[model samples]
Structure formats: C-alpha cells, structure tokens
Target: MLNSFDQKKQKILQEIQSDDLDLSPKGTIDELCIPIINLINSNDDMVTTSSCSGRVSVYLEGTKSNRAVVSKGNHGRWLFVTHEPHDLKDWTSKINFVYTSSFPDPNARLILYKFEPLILHVKCRNLETANKLYQVAMNNGFRESGIGSNFNVAIRISIKLDIPIGYKSPKDEEFEEDILNLFVTKDYIKYIDQLSLERFEENSKKLNQLYKAIEKDLSNGTVLTIKTNKPNWESKEERRRRMVKEGLKRQEELRELKQDQIQ
Candidate 1:
C-alpha cells in the first residue's frame, strides 16, 4: 500500500538510525529535541556546530490565563506533559512549574503514550531468504514505523482492533473484558506489539525448515510455517472459556429480566 516515495523515506529513515545507532543512548533521544538542537547547532549540512557539549539553558513557558503546567522544554522545543500538578515529583515538578503557571488538576484526564518493544528472534536458511520474508511482511499491512529510536517496527494492527461493538448493557465488567480482548488479538500481538520481527522472522524461517523436516506430524501435512508469534495462544484459549461463561451469565440475566416483565 505504501508508494515508492514511502519506500524511499523508509530507507532514508533507516539511514538516520541504523542498528548501531539504536543501541546508543544519544541515538534514542527525543525526536522533538533533536530538531530544536539541530536548528541552534547544525549548519547547512545538518551537522551540529555546538562548541561545548555540556548542559544547555532550557526555557519553559507557562499558559497565560489559568497558568497550569502544560508544557516543558525539551532539547529546545516545548513538550506537553499529561500528568497533573500533584502527580509531578522532583525535577519534573520544578520543570512543571517553570513551564506553565496553570498546573493540571488532580481530576484532569490524561492519556499516557509509551513505546512497547516487540522482539523476534528468527532463524532461516540464508540472508537472501530472510530478505524475502521481510519483503512479504511489508506487502501485508505492516507499516515501517518504529518504536522510539528502535528500528523494530510497531504493529498498528493491535491498536486498530480495539474498537467497541454492539449495544451498551448494564454489565460493565463484562463489557470491559470484551473491550480488552479486542485490543490483544493474536494478529495484533503476533505481528505488531510484543514480538520482535527481525529475530522472530529468522526463527520462523528456521521453524518452517523444521516443520518441513516432519511434515507428517503436522496437522495440515505441510512443512511451511509463517513467522507469526503465538503470544495469544493461551489467552485465546482462555477467551473461549470466558465466552462460554459470559454466555451463560447473560442467558440467566435475560431470563430473569423476561420473568420480571411477564409478572
């Protein structure tokens, strides 16, 4: 689905952060900070020109009206913090008050965004074969997006599956569980969030080779196997049991409601 331009971008992006760069602390620094610092330091060639490499003066700005702590200074750019005034501690508190006069209240709703790593260790025949497998994954809906500075791609499929369905019921607990399950589907977990693709792909290629060795033992009588991890195997099995239990509970509730209506 990605165009040639996207592919070019992917390559360019990869150039910015190779495997070695990813392993470095400086490489994983906040993206917003990089640009601000770049503007102040980098020249026409986009190389840093800063003579000294120690601490720099960061200016934090506060809101005009309510004066709540909303944003803080990153390398040079302002970053919005989600947590409220009371929740902040130590250096974060000082930074919070310095940035915004209006601090977020205790009741203020916040959505915390974080990066989760998915590591896959895959074994395969040769380098050429491994490259082909990576190509196949790209063809699927897998995006080239990475988590933090890590080159490993983040699977969007899990986030996509967390949609609410059907009418609302009084059973809040059941509804919450259903919503949670939808978010952690195997397709999302296998490809997107938890498993490391590069490592797993190699492992999977090896698995395919192993499966081929004993095709007779396989249920489908085939040796070929895709490198999708089985993170949801146990969870899925538990889901089946939960479904039966919820069905029974719902039926009983429905029966009671019907009886009340009849009486």
Candidate 2:
C-alpha cells in the first residue's frame, strides 16, 4: 500500500509541475498564498491540487419574476473581479453602465458586489497526513478545513474561510435612498461602492494574516498531529463478537445488582 501511494504521489507531482494542469480560475496560482503552497508542495507527503486567494466581484442576476418571462431565462453574470482593493469611481462607472444598459432586461438589473475568502485544496499521501494538515489549518483560523475524497484518492484536504460581503438589490430606489442618507451623499451608488471596497480590503487583510500563521507553523514544525474522525475497519464477525461480549457483560452486572438488592 505504501509503495502504491508513493507511486501515485510522484505521478501527481509530475502533473502539477507540467504546464498542462491549471488549478486556478485565471490559470495562475494566487501570489499571496504562493509561499504556503510552495511549502506544502515541498513536503513529501502532500501537494496542492487547487487554490484561490479570494476576490471581490460585481455581478448581475435576473429577478424571479423576470426568469419566467424572459426568453433566454435569467442567469447570473460577472461584471468585474479583483483580488486587490479597487477605486470607488471605477466600480461606480461599471455599476452605472450595467444598470443603464438596455441589453439586460429591466427586470434583470439587480447588481451585486461580493467578497469571497481564500480557499485551498491539498492532496495528502495518506489519511494520517491529511489529519495533521487539517489540524494545523483549523488551529490557524481555517475553521472550514476538512477531508474530502475523489473516488480512490481518499485524502483530499480542503481549507476554507467563510468571510462574505455583499450588497442586495443595489439598484432599488428605497435601498439607495437609505444608504444615501446614512452616508450623506447625493451619489449614493458611489458611496455604497466605496464602502464595499473598504470592507473587502479589511477582510482580505484578515485572510492574509491567517495564511501567514499557517506558513509560520508549517515552517517551524509546530503543527500538531490530531486524531481524525475516520472510522476504523473491522470485519463483520469481529464486530458481532464485540457486541455479544458487551451484551453479556451488561447482563452480568444487572444480575449482580438484583442479587445484592434481595440480600
């Protein structure tokens, strides 16, 4: 089993080094987490299969009422994406164009801005290695890390953080009015755009700190080995015998208690 696992690991490492494999949305690994990725890949027992440094995006989706009436049906479309902070004026122009454009049905004009968190998937050589990695990730603020599988490849470690930011019904008049009052701005759209950008920057910095923590533990060999919840294998006969023994022990205790009560 060890030999077979080693062979598979070598094959996967070769594929990762080759140019044919693209594990990122933009065909490039995230620069922010590149050091962490390199550290994991350097280990003999692990390799990263996919990763993302997270992003903020502007998108449009049709309303429920519009979905049934539209010929092509309602679908979400991304208008912009950035991994770093963006200017308020830049997003304001894009949002205005999307809202004012006639190509999208009037009912499909809800624009939204969103922030996503950093994510990474690591493939471990075995379940033990996966458990160690999962422990380290959870300790470093990646609370969503866990084990996933792909057919026979049993130990895929998923690392994720769930920091999300979004605007709902950005083009709604009442919503716009409320935000305009709060920010004291006649250009309420620009105000919201700037506000979202600032929040995104804050969340991005938090994610970066988490990454650095993980990298530090990994480099310093401080990651702890914790037992995972994976079940142990047992034959049907062995399980049946164990259950029978436990039942017999319980019966003996009950009889002893009854006898003592009678005495």
Candidate 3:
C-alpha cells in the first residue's frame, strides 16, 4: 500500500512539474496558496491536486423565459473576477455596461457574488496522513475539511470553509437611484468586497500558522490536538452516500486489475 502511494505521488508530482499545473480561472497553484502548497508538497506523504484562494465575481444571469435552460447553460457568466480588492469605479463601469447591454430583458440582472474561504485538495500517502491533514485543516478554521479515497488514490484530504459571503442581489433601483442607498450602491459593493478580501487574507494567514504548528508538533514528537466548533455543513447521510459511491468505484477498479493480471 505504501509503495503504491509513493508511486502515485511521484506520478502526480511529475505531471505538475511537466506543465500540467493549474492554469484555470481559479489561478495557478502559486497564485492560489503557494506557501501552504509548498509546505504540503515538501512532505513525502502529500501532494495538492487542486486549490482556489476564493474570488469575487460579477455574474450575468440569463433571461427569465429561458431561465431553466440558461441556468443549465451558464447561469453565472463571469463578467469580472478578482482575487484581491478592486476599485469601485472599475466595477461600477463594468456593471453599467452589463446593465445597459441587457436593456430588452428587464429580468436579466447582473449580480455580484463573493466566494469566501479558500479550497485545497491534497492527496496523502495513506488514510492516516489524510486524516492528520484533515484535522490540521479543521483546526485552522477550514470546518468543511474531510477525507476520502478511491481505488487508484487511497487517501485524499480536502480543506475548505462553509461561510456564505455574498449571494444577495443588489436592488435594481441602485443602478438608477440618484442618491445612494445603504442597501445597494457601488460603494457598498466595494465595501463588502473589501471585507471578504480581508477575511480571505486573515484565513490564509491562519492556515500558514497552522502549518508551522504542525511542523513544530512533529519535531517535538507530539500529537497535535485542536479545539474547534463541530462542523454542520454536510449531513451524515450525504457523507455516507459519497463514501459508498467511492467504495463501489474502488471495487470496480480492483476487479479490472484482477482481470488484467489473469490475462
């Protein structure tokens, strides 16, 4: 099992080094969470598969008549995305352009949504290592962290948070209102965006500190203990269903392996 894990880790690391690194909308590994990614990859027991540092986006919802179909299409077309704080004027200008473009469809709305809390997926050497990483992540405020495995990859750790940052739609009046209302305005949106960015920064710092603490505990030959609130994000039934699905996948893989060996 250990040998299998090592081989898989080597293959994944090679893929990462060979230009298969993250270059998506979520940004690259270095841009997302370099320090933590570096620290985890440095260990022989782990390698990050995917991650996102979180983002604030201006999304344009599709037409109301075709809402169901368009929701299935591209519900949130990203007009803009930022990992850091943005200028209010820039956002306002962009919003105005989108609002004007969708003139015929009054129901067509431009929404600003902020996805707070970073997400990181790490493949560990074994179930034990995955559990350790999950615990450490939970300690660092990633209450949504969990452990899972498949036949090919025996251990996977996910680090995340359940904080709902931005989903509220700004009032339509705010666009035409001469006087800015506290509820909806370009400045208000900027303020909220800035707050979410600050929270992301704070949580990122905590993650770094947690990594350092884990390192210290390992050096001292002591088990790390963390005190944190119970996670209520996912229900037990949901988790059980997911685990059962993974188990079925693993069984199929093993059957395939056996057939290949016999042939």
Candidate 4:
C-alpha cells in the first residue's frame, strides 16, 4: 500500500489531468491558463509538462466568474477554490503536506519549493474549504494579477494524494458560509490577526494538522513564502497636491506659448 503522502499526491495528479475543458464553463476554461502563466513566471518559460491530481469540481458565480473549486479524495473533502478571480495565480502557493491539508485531504495539499519565485500550489479537498480559505487569505490581504479578459484559465497541473478515509470536517461547512464576512482592505493586518485568532479558536484540531505538515517542511529547509498586503501610503491629498503642481507648470507654459504666438 502506498504511504499516506504518496497516496495524496496520486489523487491530486489524477483529478487535474482528467478535467474536461468542454464540460467546463467559460470561466473555468479561463483558469486553465493559470498554470501556463505561473510556469512562465516561475522560470520565464512555459512548462513542458504540468498536471493536476484528484477529483476536483468547480462552481461558477453569476457575475464575472464567481466560482469555487472543490476536491475529493479517499480521506475527505474541503473547499479548494473559493472565488476564481480572473488572475488564477492569486490562488497558488507551496507548502509541506503529510496528507496535504496539514491534515489528510490531498486536495488541500500545500506544495513548497526553495529559492523559487514565491508561488502557492493550492489543491483543496472540496469547494467549501477552498472558498473559506481564499476568503480568509484575501481578508488577510492577497491580490491576483495578469492575463487579459480573452484568456481565462480552468485547468492546470495536478498532483495525487493518498489519505485515509473519514477525515472530513463538519464545522468547515459553517465556516465556509461565514467566510463572506472576511475581506482584504486597508485594515488587512487587523483581519489577519483576527483570522489567526479565529483559526485557533474555531478549528484548533485542523490547525494542528496544518501545523504538523508545515513543521516538517520547516525542518527540511523548504522555504515557505506567503504574500501579504500592506496599505498604500499615498492618499488623495498627496496625489492632488502633486497634480496641482503639474497643472500650474502647464499653465505657465501655456502663458509663454501665447507670448510666442503674439510675437
């Protein structure tokens, strides 16, 4: 029998590789471009090979592309993708996984790397946890960028995960719904603190799982880089003052132009 970690990896690889783009909606079709872009960003070159593993499903939002991607493995299911913001790169990073979720869900696998441009490889066990995690991460401050409207991404690399069955969380359902209350704004630092607190208070058991997985990575010297949001210092007043100065300079030049015109 495959070890727990090996099993999870296999599960993730199979799901992503088997996704049907045609059956997928326009928004999902767009997400496929994400890995291609990420591969480029990571190496400034397209990846010759990329794949996804696990049984993953996506649901779209009515406006823009509001969708959540979920994954299922022998172990359990959790939210994988919350909101499919056009820029899919926003949803990826690398981490350690004993069973992926820091718990056992292969879909919530956190793939980590060393000395690579920071990227988080996210594969959640279900859409609910995926959505909740995204909201919480964004509420803690994260941003997505890249790709014009024409090119949307749906599928990307897949990895397999093998986890023992019957590890799903019942609380995650309620947590997913409450995720809407989270947001990434100027007060993001506060939100991050609140989220960390809530995470400990609400889901200490699962948090311990994630902690163990991450602990292994740290011990092995696998660097983890998470993106953080900071407030922009320039305010409307500062911007306006700079603009006004430029406008005054233009007016002076206009006056000189009239003098030259008359002469």
TM-score for all predictions? 0.19, 0.53, 0.58, 0.18
- Candidate 4 per-residue lDDT over residues 114-202, each given as its tens digit: 11011233433345434443443333222331222212112211122222211222224654421111112324323333333343233
- Candidate 2: which stretches are off by over 4 Å? 1-25, 62-75, 87-89, 94-109, 150-263
Against the reference, the lDDT scores of all candidates come to 0.28, 0.50, 0.50, 0.29
Q: Which lDDT value does model 1 have at 232? A: 38
* lDDT of candidate 1 over 138-179, digit per residue (tens): 344234422322122222111121111111111247533111
Candidate 3: tens digits of C-alpha lDDT, residues 1-263: 45876887667666554422234443234244655555666677777677666555554443355646324133344445556544323565533332121122234433435454566778876677777776766665666667766411222123222221222234467564112112254455566666666766776676577668557542234322211111336575664454345544554555465445423
- Model 3 gets an lDDT of 0.50
Point out where model 1 deviates above 4 Å. 1-125, 145-221, 224-263
Please report, as a residue range, the 10-residue window in candidate 3 with the lowest summed lDDT.
222-231
Which 10-residue window in model 2 sums to the lowest lDDT?
177-186
Off by over 4 Å in 3: 20-23, 62-72, 86-89, 98-110, 151-183, 217-263
Clashing residue pairs for model 2: none
Question: What local lDDT score does residue 129 receive in model 4, on the 0 to 100 scale?
Answer: 33
